[model samples]
Target: MASVTDLQYVALAVPDLAAEREFFGQTWGLTEVGEEDGMVYFAAEGMPHPYVIRLRRDDERKTDLVGFSAASREDVDALFEQVKAAGAKIIAEPGPVEGLAGDYGFRFFDPDGRAMEVVTGGAQRAHRTLGKGEAIPVGISHVVFHSPNHPALVEFYQRALGFRLSDWIGDFMGFLRCNSAHHRIAVLPGPPALNHIAFDVASVDELMRGLARMHESGIHLSWGPGRHTAGDNTFCYFITPNGNAVEYTSDLEHVDEATWVPTTYQPGPNTIDQWGTGRIITGNVPHAEMTPDKGLWQVPA
Candidate 1:
């Protein structure tokens, strides 16, 4: 099994580049770094390149999840083998992206057709003007994936990628970690577009301030300005310029290698929000009416 050394950046095929840049820039303070072939990349000053969002052209099929940046090239080699062994489909073989820096990796699809990958060392970190955690703290923290086969997939990450299970928000969400930074990725039970990508913040107050900015700018809040019992992180969701969800979060439970117990089980949403996650109906979300079940599972991953 290969270890999931670290979480690389995620690549989402966005429809609009200008909109995403304005959304991410205004909401999270991301700066537009570079562009190529109708695709634009935005970055947080803290995280490195290829982590940027890739805007797709009209004729291209939209890509859902493209995971990137593992801890080691060796781990990548090992997981590449594991992915093959599991009978998962492979698209691009592992290698270097000709035009990008440090993005030496490959592409494949998750069970649901999500374009996932393992990459590293592409594009140097330019650091965004805005990062997770301000006075409330800041920076992009982690991503969560939805899977129907939780245990089977958990083994994939645990055995092949070496993600230590941090805790379980519910039977649906499994918080996994690679580094001391609480969690890099979360495995959730299937069907929605990945739950959302969270960007770290300094405090709940900062989250509020950031939310205020979003509100004033007409960016409707998605989920909350509340706290979750799982990691003890304060969270709020906003629609980013990319149509991708970004969370402004703070105060997650800090753990050391010693006390960090990888556990699981479904927790009630009430426990998920102790500080009170404000009312969140599908209406607040952009495509809510279409996804009455909280998600549209059939979207090509």
Candidate 2:
């Protein structure tokens, strides 16, 4: 089946663009790649997806788009047909993408009304192997979302995007993978909203190094500096200036697609955070509070 190969970028509209631009470029370790048509793009040092993040000014904070990459224009067209056949609302038909990272793509609204895009043939940026202790994100890791009908939404992604089930945190949360990485997307039961966006760091050492950097920079640690049972990844979660939850994670388990069996872990305090360190700080939960995304059903600019 034609499928999205990886996550490309997440576009966000924040009321305070200046603070967000500074937070991502300076503190979060993404390089400012370009600014075009009032949008600012940021790229990770270790990945070649052009820009992994796009930020724009808006009166209120909301998710603009979550983009995924297709291997070719053929796959893009195939996936577009698949999405449309699944009864998703089409935003735009596949065509040449605009702005700095020019490519062939299409946009649509997911079951929860969040805007999504799949693209191919963008200019690939030259990237180098990030050294140990660099303490920065290597690339975009995974995204988690909250849905009112989580199971149905999970089914939608699987049937439409060619995602496979990785594991489940009981019946409440489901992890889906498109590649060897355990999961590139996960779903939880709640209002239609994003939970968090995670970034891959080099290792557990880098995860700690990043914790220190975030501390020194006065960014509040919302959760973690601990391990999660599902992915076996070390995590350190923080809230961005615009209240979006972001995670710096490392050591995510890679699975063999042919042999791996999905596990349903019982939900508990230790299930989400095995190390128990994240709970040491009072009121730090596994994820942020749930609210419907304000940008739902809005066409991307």
RMSD of 2: 0.9
lDDT of 2 by residue, 1-301 (tens): 7778998899999999999999999999999999988999999999998999999999999999999989989999999999998899999999999865547999999999999999888899999999979998999999999999999998999878889999999999999998889999999999899899999999999999999999999999999888998989999999998888999999999989889999999999898889899889998877745679999999998
What shift in Å separates residue 6 of candidate 2 from its native position after superposition?
A: 0.2
Superposed by TM-score, candidate 2 places the C-alpha of residue 159 at a distance from the truth, in angstroms, of 1.0
Stretches of candidate 2 off by over 4 Å are none
The 0-to-1 C-alpha lDDT of every candidate, in the order given, reads: 0.63, 0.92
Cα shift from native, residue 205, model 2 (Å): 0.5
Clashing pairs in 2: none
| Clash count, predicted structure 1 | 37
The Cα error of candidate 1 at residue 110, in Å, is: 1.8
